[model samples]
Target: MSHRQYAVTHTDIEKLNARLLSISLSRDERDWQSVFHTHHFTELFFVVSGEGNFLFREKLYHIKTGDLVIIPPYMEHTEQSIPDTPLEYYVIGVDGISFQPAGEQTCVQVFCNVSNKALVEEIFSQMLYEMRNPAYGSDKICQDLLEILILRIIRSQHVIPVPIASTYMTKECARIKEYLDSNYSEPITLDTLTDLTHMNKYYMAHSFAKYTGKSPIQYLNDRRMQAACTLLRDTDHSISAISASVGFSSQSYFTQAFRKKYGMTPIRYRQSQAGDDAANGS
Candidate 1:
């Protein structure tokens, strides 16, 4: 999906007259399929658990926990559980306002990979709690919470950099991330990022770890490992070739890192993905 940006503010959120329609939570214990359903109101569904095939209109998307989907009104969608792995999720319906973010009314990204599942779950659980027991101002509170939910969706749809103690540090860390993103398959070292940023190696490492939460080498390795996963799943390359292609010095080291991160060898991961494809008949 193409990326779009929106400038949001507290006042903008307050001005929105968004309304809540319903809140429903489901925990599927058996493999099942839902009949195609459509609504006149928009639905924001968050997958709290399980991995399955999510059908929107007629197209299917393989989805799992921590994946969030936003479906607007009149969009027919359904879902089917994978055997031995049913889904548990929350569906929040809303009306009275569209998802008009602050800046331009650009197209909203439908799918977001949420990193903080606990925060999402807590907010939804609180919404459900308020829905189940109405107080004197529960309707208003829930309505505001629904708006917060919409704002959360908007927040997830974009890649906003979190501010650090120093703005310069944030930019430098971002520069390191961009460099690694573009050069994962190339030889990279702490000195490389230091030279590019013109900062001391110690300072560079400290700033990057402080802001990005990963040391310089660890971040670089992460990018390489991600690329290795794609190659392992999609290509028929030998392990040694794949290792070299991803900048790993040796196949044994690559295997160890892959197994440490994924709890399985690259070959096992490939075979498992192939098995899944076969079972899904995709």
Candidate 2:
């Protein structure tokens, strides 16, 4: 008997230092509202079914089933569904790493018409299942799955994984930014942020401004303005109602802020958007 033996060689794999933060599946039956928001960690958005548009960096990208979008930290984005088709998807939040596609300077990437749809869907489904039903080693399993998912994405999309350095100021500023994103409609003040973060108000303000190039209140107002623009374009809500809905106590104040930001009154801005939509036959 003639037999040939092949020697096996060890391969070194780079360690991936990352943490799985959260995972959730969204469906149309829940009637969820989409709002412009930002996170301090990377977000993996997978379209499971239906059609919609993803708003990122003030541009809208059409998305449908089997699309995958990777949004880096501190990127403002939102997703809205087509009225008839609606949207069903999964959003997974991961920290400590971001992706940069080959030859691209930006960290955000979108892979449309993913060839391995079934495999991707199965992985997300398993991750969701493990999250909802936790037993021994479930956390480990989820972490491993997250790594596998990221590896698959890198391999298929030709993206590079860049490690993020978590620092004290980064964490503190991220906490403050997240709070502003989530509670923009609520009454907020420096005292509120101080209570929430346990940091001195002055130092927190300075650090946050250094991190985001805007004060905490400026960021909050920006968030509110983004939400107001969305409402003005999509809903028939009056200016006063929209103002209140977006955390402005008075319509006049909201209009004044809106004019300062857009160089036009709120009504004029809405009319301009309407005209553009009509011109495009949308």
lDDT of every predicted structure (CA atoms): 0.74, 0.86
Residue pairs of candidate 2 with colliding backbone atoms: none
Clashes of each: 0, 0
Q: Estimate each model's TM-score.
A: 0.49, 0.62
lDDT of 2 by residue, 1-282 (tens): 999999999767688787899999997763566777878788999999999899974478999998999888887899888878878999999988887778865466465457899999999999999999999999999999999998888778888887765222377788888888889999999999999989999999998886566899998999899889989999889999999988998999999999999899999989999999999999
Clashing pairs in model 1, backbone N/Cα/C closer than 3 A: none
Candidate 1: stretches off by over 4 Å: 1-14, 31-33, 100-109, 159-282
Q: State residue 202's C-alpha deviation in candidate 1, in Å.
A: 68
lDDT (Cα, tens digit) per residue for candidate 1, span 138-176: 888878777676667667665222111222235677678
